[model samples]
Target chain A: MILWNIWLTQDYFEKQNTILTYSAVISKAYQKEEVISYEKWSECQNYYTNPENLDFLYSIPVTLAILALREFSDDISRRTET
Target chain B: MSIETIAKAIGSILQDTYSRNYGLSKGFNLMEKEIALSSYHLLMRYADNDEDKNEIIATMIHMLSAPFSDHEIDKITQYVREIFFKQYPDEAKRVWLALIKYSNYKKANPSFYRYQDEDSLNKAEENEEKFVQQISSDKNLTLDLSEISLEKSEAYLLARAFVITPYDTDDKDFSNFLNHILPIVIGDLTKVEDYSYNRTRESRKFHHESISDIEQYLANLFLEANFENSKSIFTTLVNSLSGNAQRQRFGRDDLFEFVSTTLDYFVLKLYDNGNLKIDP
Candidate 1:
């Protein structure tokens, strides 16, 4: 049940913040002009293995996602008022 | 009764309830059936134990006012057990494997806006089509390759090079042009180590080892090619660069920029003006 709830939350977060989450994953694994090596790929995957690691990876994207969603809501509300 | 017995009974009841609520009057609706299966799977995943699953099933049977016969309970338990323990786990593993394949493919083809969600991906594709149409369809669109990035210029040149008309890929000189001279012209051979698993790595090494006077060799190869439409432009390019190569004025980046821009302009003219007019 605990695992299921965690998976559901993760899935929900993914649907809501597709760009943010994916960009975070890509940025964590790659940099411009540098090859994405197997070592970098493993490092990104390892972050999802534990709660502490997952928290570290999610922090930035989650913050940005909330800001983006809030901005979208504001834009919609403004358009509706007009 | 065994755990399987209760699960089977519950699974049947769940299926019947789904059919009553979501099934079309004429036949089974595939979309609704999919939703039902996914909902049932989610419920099973959440239950986390046989007892929890069986209790849910028993409660549902009681609420629905359905006859909870012993045989019926046994059959539902069996079906639920098979799905939870066997089928769903296999599906999850299949999904995991596909994700790995997709991740690796993305690493190989690195692009800024290419890796996106479905809507954005479609938008990106549409934008690409618009760009191609704008460039390919317009006859008077004069593109100054200098103003644009090296990537776009390279793409234009390569796109023209790959065309079958006038330039035959099966020809030895054309093959030489692509395999040997093009890398020197493009100036990316030095950064071949930074390419993650590209097919051109071995060919790059071969080109580097075999070619000594790369600039002169590239110019000679271009002149040697019997270009049906752009021979005069190719000759002019060779003539213009020969002095610079002799004086050693052009560096790798300078050579790449000049060659790529010149070729980009040639191809753009081919599409824009519908004629490869010789520049005086």
Candidate 2:
């Protein structure tokens, strides 16, 4: 079960990278006079399919901040509840 | 001589050696040397076979393996040796043979010899200092994220990625839903401070919720959006939040302020790209 979850996380990260790649390509094409090709879009999709690249790309601080905010929110909720 | 007498003789020899060679006023140093000498002496006695030598040797080895301070070593050595060696000349030849054999065995076992060496002792001392420092730095040291289980840490990280991502929807209700869930995602990544009220008074403000709360909320929202179904909107949101947080050391108010600003920036960017519509 744990192994399955880890694999799932890896999958999510890969998909995230695909989105990143697509955005990058679209943005670049917008600035360039050269025509964007379907081949480049396909390349971006291929990059997203690979999970290994996204492992190091995950952020720590954002996670910590979100956790902090969640706690603050909970405290606010508790205060209101009381 | 009896085993007790032999132990006594060894103890006396060590005490005399400590007094004669190392100054007694250096109490800790003298005690440490006494323990080492007594340990060697006990092992020697076991090999001599005044009694069930193997059992005695095993017990002594276990004792030596335990953590011992220099002062405790001195006191314990005195008791161990005195209890073991009481009779002397009659068992003298056996004691000598035991010492020789044991010494030879130790020489052959290089690893064991190294473990009992001064270098190993010094390394143990260094490790003890590091442990003390680690404990001292965070009174709630046991609950610190660095000390948490890897699974929890990873869960927290995943939740964090989910919360910081700005949600965009053509519908107002869905964006509001994402905003509402964001706090729960943040909660899952926090660790509870374990110090007393006075000690952790500062940290108490941080540990109100479990990391899973935020993680589960963000995960569900992401899944609802078919995060994989969309292009890099989710990834960009995670990256933006992470990037901003990394660039600044935020104060208490800064967290809320940063999130608001980040949301505004993303909304503007998405609106310019014609991918998002704002009702304001």
Candidate 3:
């Protein structure tokens, strides 16, 4: 099932989407050192297919971005549900 | 946390994901919870308890989802503010600042640290620097992309291909050599599907061309070498070609680099085994 999720992710990214795959997520985890740098993580996530070069991509991030497209708020009082 | 703990969490999430799949007929059943859960699986490895694990994972997923949104960033800030801030103010402050830094960094440059390993990236940079140095010193230095006359380059063959021309000096037939040997070396590969470097246009082209070039170069090399069991290796590469061809879609420059690097190492093996047949 983990492998299946990974395959789906590879397929999704290969098709040029942002949805994270399991393998990519693991690869991202491999990148996180002392800090959780999403910038570094995003840099590693590939949204295309390239079998000869797999090192440039990783396997994790958000999928809710597909749905929640809201304006960025400034005040903490104007932000969040949970 | 222990690997067993993380594995257990993964198992639980997989079960949740599995149960979610019952009603869906065509599309996948993955939702925010599942995606968030999977993303946190990495952070879950750091969790000492389920409570902290769940909260941290939720915060990470939320941050990942709306990385740029002040609200998402605040949600994580809130997580730090209410929970850790009260318990460990210093640590909480550090984390909160780190979170903000991370969010800003993502917004500013969503693409950094794309390298597979620092070592390789460093080596590539060093090679580039040396290439510039050499080109500066001897502007006449052109790459030798011919068949490489294996006997003449026996020293280079014995060492790494980099010892001769480390840069993307396209003059050497190293790429072609890699292309030739990969079909034979394909057997030792455990997971061909891991190749997912497809980031940019040039990288994708390299990935696709690398695989396609390998097949083409190997066929040419086989015909040229005309070894005793050339037919067997030739047949094998052709048989294995379909998988790589399919993998070409997932190819990237690093994947091509990987193939090239693996070829550099494996060619030595082939030579020692007398399979490379370094004649003429």
Candidate 4:
């Protein structure tokens, strides 16, 4: 059930606008360290993809900025209440 | 012997030699002789073994003898022998072997002594002094864009961002945050996403763009999202690129003021709209 919810969340985030979406966050991670090799980026993506790293996810400045947006904040509030 | 002992012996020998025979007691010549003697003494004392010590001693003697007449050379050699030979018999043998071997080598390869001579050394010293004066005066001391290209500027921006992060922030979490945010900041300001298709091939490209107003652009992005510490972060980002501007000595502060002016207006705007949240 938890895995299903996580997958649903990931899918939902992926479907949003690319500029402030999960893809943007991941692209930012890959682009942050210009010297990071493709393999290193893939490894980091896998690491963050895990549900256990949610705190790691929430810690990002961009994540916080995105969450501050009314769309994301309202969506999160609605999800949490349900 | 310890370095101090060796240094003292060398100093005394040079002083006595200068007084008795060399007559190098005034002006640039005297200063050059003193510097050379000190440098040779340092090399001889720290040499790996007897062979290296002999080579260094030979080089020193050959270079020092270049301006001296045969009569003066004989007098200085006799003076050196009386003080140094008696105190160090083994060192005397090494010195003798070095003089014989390297004097022949010096004669055979005269071109090799070009920089080892006084004129070249004096010229080098003059250049170094000029460089020091240039930096101290901060005149024509601005770093060129060629020296720090766009890629390097981006790297410095990221490094500066990491440096200005709060000291108390958790390292892993902050690192993760930086890794996730810096790219977005860089990309938004510097590049735009574009896709191209050629029959069966489709490719994505990031088209580069130059920002005319970094502060204004950042303000729009940060103020729209209501970023915490946006002013401070934007200031650092602007400051990081200040070196790219010519005459950076005063230009940096001017650029910083511009960033402050541009960002502070947004801060005021957000406050007026009752959107500013002071999260304690």
Top-TM-score structure, candidate number: 1
lDDT of 3 by residue, B1-280 (tens): 1223233434444444335434433122222234433333334333456455435533432232232323233333333333444444333333332332232323333332555888877876565434333322332333343423222222111112211111122322333444443442353232343345443321212123223333333433443444543445455544664555545455342434444543454455456457756531
Off by over 4 Å in 4: A1-82, B1-64, B69-74, B111-280
| The 10-residue segment with the lowest total lDDT in model 3 chain B | B156-165
Candidate 2: interface RMSD equals: 28.7
Better candidate by TM-score, 1 or 2? 1
Chain B in candidate 2 has what TM-score?
0.19
Tell me the tens digit of each residue's lDDT in model 2 across A1-82: 9999999999887777755655555444533534455455335434434544323333111121122222333442233222
Docking class of 2: incorrect
**Best model per DockQ:** 3
State residue B198's C-alpha deviation in candidate 1, in Å: 11
Pick by lDDT: which candidate is best? Answer: 4
lDDT of 2 by residue, B1-280 (tens): 1233334434444444434444433212222233333443434433534344433443343232233443444344334423333322223222322322222232233222236788886776565434333322221211122222222222222222223223333534234434433433333223234445342322322232323223223333443455543334354335444644443344343333334444555455456545544322
Which residue pairs in candidate 4 have backbone atoms (N, alpha carbon, C) closer than 3 angstroms, thus clashing?
none
- TM-score per candidate: 0.22, 0.18, 0.19, 0.20
* Model 4 Cα lDDT, one tens digit per residue, B108-188: 333322577888877765654353333222312222223222222332222222222221223333334334444434433
> What is the C-alpha lDDT profile of model 1 across B59-139, one tens digit per residue?
332222222233333333333323432445432222222222222222344443545688877766566434433332233
TM-score of 3: 0.19
Native-referenced DockQ of model 2: 0.01
What C-alpha lDDT do the candidate models reach, one value each? 0.36, 0.36, 0.35, 0.38
